[model samples]
Target chain A: MAIKVHGIALSTCTGRVLLCLLEKGLEYEIVPLDLANSAHKKQPYLSLNPFGQIPAFEDGDVQIFESRAITKYLSRKYKDTGIDLLGSSSLTETTIVDTWMEVESHQYNVPMQKIIRQMIVNPAYGIASDEKIIEEELEKLGKVLDVYEERLSKCKYLAGDFYSLADLHHVPYLVYFMRTLKSSVITSRPHVNAWWKDISSRPASVKLAESMRI
Target chain B: MAIKVHGIALSTCTGRVLLCLLEKGLEYEIVPLDLANSAHKKQPYLSLNPFGQIPAFEDGDVQIFESRAITKYLSRKYKDTGIDLLGSSSLTETTIVDTWMEVESHQYNVPMQKIIRQMIVNPAYGIASDEKIIEEELEKLGKVLDVYEERLSKCKYLAGDFYSLADLHHVPYLVYFMRTLKSSVITSRPHVNAWWKDISSRPASVKLAESMRI
Candidate 1:
């Protein structure tokens, strides 16, 4: 049997895993879980993912959840699938991959989540938007983006010259981010925008991203 | 030259790298950074760690920061040093290690930071402490702890029975946590407390933790 992926279409986390799979040239069936109905929280799904989150991977007898973990697992298990998602054999390359992952989680993801919660989720869900708090949070993010521009200026990708999982991991977020920001941040940083354009234009990336629009 | 570790004793992140070194039976010099003096954020140190964080590892020509990445780098580089901090041969075990690392970063670290920010840093630094927000945050964390308890009930450690980087990653937070919580959440979870006792009793853990304390 092929692998089964449990995920919600529109989720950034699920999009993360899907993009990796597309990069790896792996074939798998998507097992859609209804995020609207909290299907993931139920027992059957919980057994597959104790955390009760989507984007759970079931590869034959093995099941792995957590987007980064799943991506790493896929990279390790199917080495011949496609590009070296983990990066080159050199230690420096691997550390760069690890560093970029931490950068995403610590610097980008945390602040971006706050911005999303305030600017998107809160207002969309009928909660009053705290403009002051949102502005403060966005400023923090904008500063971080300045660092991103600096880093990208030095290297072609976040991890280094190579387009590794580091770049891949941020694809979905950037897709939504640029759209939400109306390309203001991306347009400001030419290299960053160019990098985004390059990755988003990939055949696999374009396909996976379109499939994620359900 | 063996290696020089620049870190603060009381810092959780520094303790993370220290514990890993002890576990691997590696010899290194500890150069204690003065947090009060902003040593980490100043001049040469800041250049080594752009983020200006503690637990920066320097070995030979290789300089690495970020505790989790440092530990992973050490485990891989010194493959024959001692116990494997990454994972053993088992796929489940390796995935579990990565899984718990995510759990630490995503769930454990987030709420802990919120609580600490409100209860300790904000108050001590003359910043505002929002008790209401802290209370709300704790309830969110309490839910994650419950899930941890359920997992610990079956396994001996966070990443299953073996003491991997997953367990090590959590040590510093738990230490401060024990000191901070009026009502002990770990104690309430019998299995988790048992696991903590097991890890806490290790000689290396005790020594490294004590020596690193400011």
Candidate 2:
């Protein structure tokens, strides 16, 4: 049976998972949950994911949620496909994957949420945008970008020499962020931008991006 | 060479790593970075963990920061000890682990920070507590606890069957929360309270809590 992914195509997280699927050259069905129709909050869907979030996944009898986790699971389950996504099962490489995953979730995700809230969510809710606050957030974000730049200079990917899901997870948010801000922050950080460019230009990423209409 | 963990005992995050180490029956040196003494911000330490966060771990030449990541690394690195701390390599189990981790990080950690700010941090800075606002935050937190109660009714641990790092990540926060909150919100939720009791009774948890003076 084909894998089924329950998520909106346009969602950055869903897009992240979609990119992973495409990268692994796996076929999956997109059971898009209409967020506009309040489908996510309704019954059945809530039973699948109590938190009422996406993107959720179902493969035959198995079901899972959380984009990063879903991607990691898929990577491990189908280990021999397009890329060695999790790296070798050695202690060092595994630690590297573990470390960067935490960095992405804890350090990067928090600041990115702040940026999203200020730039998109707040204004969409008819709330006023404070340029002073936005600029402050941007500055802090710039500092984080600096860290990425330094790290990328040393290695091709966030975790190490391998292009694991660690790099894949960042793709969607970076795309959304770049789309919304259209700023020179990434451009200024040459190594960071270069590494991003390398990943963003992948055939899998391109196919997923196009499918999601990003 | 022995493993060296740099963090203060009283810190909740630091306690998480200790709990994992204790659970695995690993012997390690604890190099306490005195938060009161401004040691975390000093040279060498800051260089190791760019975020300047506590609970940094050094095993031989491999150094990793972030408490959750460190715990995960320990669990995976020492899997031969027969402790099934990590979620299954399967897609579904990975999703469960990821979801609970998100719950621990985004939901639990956020409200706990709010409670700490209003009850401890603000008061430490001589800021007055707003009783009305605290009550509002309590209602928000109560709902989160309700979700936990619903989940614990089915599973022995947060992430399905096994006691993964998801439960361990939440243990410290529960320590602080139970101590500071005078209300019956937590105790009112029977399942949540039962889950807490089970976790608190664990030998590793007991040892970590005692070591941290929690």
Candidate 3:
């Protein structure tokens, strides 16, 4: 049976899994959840993900949720066919990859999520955007990007010279980030600007970007 | 050089690395940090982890931070001697393990962190505990545990029959959590209680718990 993902392209995390599928050159279908209607937060979908999050996956009998986890599964399951995003064969390289990936989720994604809620979600849902939150998060994000700039100056990718999941993981939110608060956060740093350009331009990311409406 | 962790036993995250090292039966040393003085957030250590988090790790040439990332590295690097916490040999099993670990971090750990701050961190610093925040987080945490209760009912551990890193990662925060909140959250659900008992009593967990002085 073909691989399947229950997610919408517009969702950055859903987009996260989709980008991995595209990068792996794998065929899959998206069973998009109706997030606006709170359908994803209700039953059936909740069975797929108790947390009522999107981008659940299925391959025959195996089912899993969590976008990052789904991508990890795909990277491992299709290790040979795909680009070897995890670098599973190299312990040291995988160590660095895991570190940067953690950095993305823990440090980068945290502030980005708050900023996205204010800049994108609030506006779309008719909730007032909190300028205070945007300011606070953007400051934190700028500091995070500073570290990224320094890291990227030393290495082509977050993990190292070779592009890995760490770099790809940064693409989705960034696509949304660059669209709303364009240029300044990214373009300010030469290395970060080049790094963002490099990864965002990847065929998989470009394809994913086209589908991200909001 | 022997495995050296720049952290303290009282720190749940530092304890996280220690649990893994003990599980692997590897000899290691804890290079304590003066978190009280904000030393971790300063120079020297900042060079170790730009994020300025506790529990930076070093094993000869390899130096990394982010406690979970460090644990992941240790699991893979010492896969043979230690218990195979990753389930790397089986793709499907690894998928489940990855799924639950993500659930642990994104879902369980998020609320737990907030609750811990309101209850434990605030008290220690002579700050009043935010009952409002504690109540809100505990409600969220209760729901998360409901999911855990259901999952544990069907399987011995979060990832299935195996006691993988998924369970191990919960130990640190939980050690602090149970100390403050205690019993009610964990013991309310029989499966969760039993599962907690089983994992926490494991020799490594017991040893790790002993060091979790807070």
Query: What are the Cα lDDT values of the candidates?
Result: 0.80, 0.80, 0.88
- Each model's TM-score, in the order given? 0.93, 0.91, 0.97
Q: A1-214 in candidate 1: lDDT tens per residue?
A: 7978899656778889889888888888889987788999988899888878777888898988888999888888887778888875899889978878887888778867776666666766789977787678777777777777877889888888888888888887766666575357677777777788888998878976787542
Per-residue lDDT of candidate 3, residues B1-214 (tens digit) = 8999998897777888999999999999888888879999999999899878888999999999988899898998898977999877788888888888889878988898898888887888899988888899899999999989988989999998988999999998887777764558998899999998898889998898887765
Model 1 regions more than 4 Å off:
A122-128, B122-129, B212-214
Enumerate residue pairs that collide in model 1. Answer: B9-B212
Best by TM-score: 3
- Which ranking of candidates, highest TM-score first? 3, 1, 2
| Among all candidates shown, the one with the greatest DockQ | 3
What clash pairs does model 2 have?
Answer: none
RMSD of each: 2.2, 2.5, 1.5
Candidate 2 DockQ category?
medium
Candidate number with greatest lDDT:
3
Point out the higher-scoring one by DockQ: 1 or 2: 1
* lDDT tens readout by residue for model 2, B42-135: 7789767777788788998889988888887888788766576777565567667877886788667777767766766677668998777677
Output the worst ten-in-a-row residue range by lDDT, candidate 1 chain A: A174-183
